[model samples]
Target: MLEIKNKLYNSKERKMQKLFNKYMGIKKFFRLKSEKIFPLNENEKILYTDKYDYKEKNEKNKSDKYLSFNKRIHILSVIPKNKIENFYYSFCNFVKKNPSKNEFSKIILDERLKKSILNYSNSLNLGGWSNLGYTTPKSKELENIVDYFHLFIFNLSEDYIGLDFTAILNKDFNHKLNEFMISEIKNEPNYCKYYVGNKRFISKTGLNKDIIRREKLDDILLEIKMRCYDFLNLYFDLFPLNNKAPITFDEYITNYEFNSKNDYLLRCYDFYIFEDKQISRDMDIIINHNDKEFSQTFLDLYLC
Candidate 1:
């Protein structure tokens, strides 16, 4: 009987010790180092590199001409105002005629209704805040008037994947769209060039920030550009512009390249080394030259 009691007490003590050790281990794992207590300036920041002198020289001579160091690359395609207007008209007509039980119907109808209300408000001079004394009236005919909404093709891994026809409704539409698209592309089965090192080794030890060789970096950038081209092609294929011949990849995307000595890229590399996972890259798009005018018109007509 005494032996059994001793065994039970020993087991309980072992369990308590295991729990306490686990808690401390976790706490230690998450604790910030003394050096990280304060923010470091660009020059003072510590990077895991053997060639510190070479890196410093490179940083001093770094050019600001290339695209940002963020893994995502922005590809811009411009559509003529007339083409966009035509597309909007066709889209509205299709939605009206088809009347399907999909979400597209609601989106299109709602936007149309809003546009009508905006036009009505403009005619009454109720929402005119612009310096222009008179507000221009929008045509009642959908085909004659241009819509303010921009179309966004969103692709998010494990989250959302679809089109956002009313992207302009949200003020942070650009950021949200880019974030979702990047997340979606990262989930692609072939998107693994960014994760090329021994993740386990890097995690057990510390990551060498200069692990990415110039040749490897070049390959990664090329792959990223190709991926961007493919993404743009897919979007255009699904929704052709003005019912015209499919635009060539070059026609759709003007530029896709990475800049040198980007801190964001370095941080992303560190994250992958430690987490054994890839973070979504960022991207920016060049809006059409007339986008500003169109945006102003949209604000004047709808938002006031």
Candidate 2:
């Protein structure tokens, strides 16, 4: 009888010990990755690189005018892997079918450049705040209140792959439009036909700092990803722009790319491809006067 009683008590003690250890494990995890609340600053702050660094920043935020969120939230907008792959495959097929007209397609067809494009698409970083502008939660009602609302701004031209003036379609089309528009307008040299990357997207989210410090921050980031994804989808579907009649290729390209900071040089092929188009056919024709090698290379690529 005594042996049976002893066994019962021993089992109960072991179970209690396991429960205590579980609780302590979670407590320690929170202590390791806690966040701080701080005021906004104009200067840049280094982003968190590791678990230890995040914990250290939490302590630093305890000082005046400095508060840190449990973790930074950044989500890439949905450009699905399958879709990107399909785009590449379709592009390759198009190049094979339309080889003559698409002399510039070789840039995208290069195996090394294509690999780089795939890798960049897989790890694209699309959305996040430069620095958060935080305000105290409006109400004392803890149920409704949050730590802060953060705003993220994105510039399409510099942040994406296969955009800007890199694509042959954009380069050729923009050049043709800019030339015609410039001749018609007086003192307007900066106008262009179409912009390669002049779009921006801004997003916002509210987070519960208390839950984040006591728990894992990955949950908050997951929620942020969903919200950001919706915003991006809507923005892409209904891009807001003022509708206007078409202008010459030079004027069109000039309007968007003049100060866009994209690196591209005007080539003879780019000029020749759009020369026969009706909108730009009236513009004074200019041949590539310099770089005989480049001109010859362009001719060879198109077999012109």
lDDT of 2 at 36: 42
Residue lDDT tens for model 2, 1-304: 0111122233675567646545644643554465344422221121111221223111221123221122222222223443556545544453343233323222335777466445544454554222212222222221121233232222333334322111112233233323332222221111112344896322112222332322222222223323333332332321222221111111111111212122121221133332222223323232333465633211111000
Q: What is the C-alpha lDDT of each candidate?
A: 0.29, 0.29
* Local distance difference test, candidate 1: 0.29
Predicted structure 1, TM vs. truth: 0.21
| Pairs with backbone N, CA or C atoms under 3 Å apart (clashes), candidate 1 | none
**lDDT by residue (tens digit), candidate 1, 1-304:** 0011122233675567646545544543444243377544433232221223233221321344222232222233333322333434544554444333334333444665435423322243233221101111122221112122233322222222233232111224323323332231211011011234654211112222233332233333333333333433433323343422222111111122222334543333222121122223322122222344532100001000
lDDT for residue 230 in candidate 1, whole number 0-100: 40
Q: Given candidate 2, what's the lDDT at residue 43?
A: 18
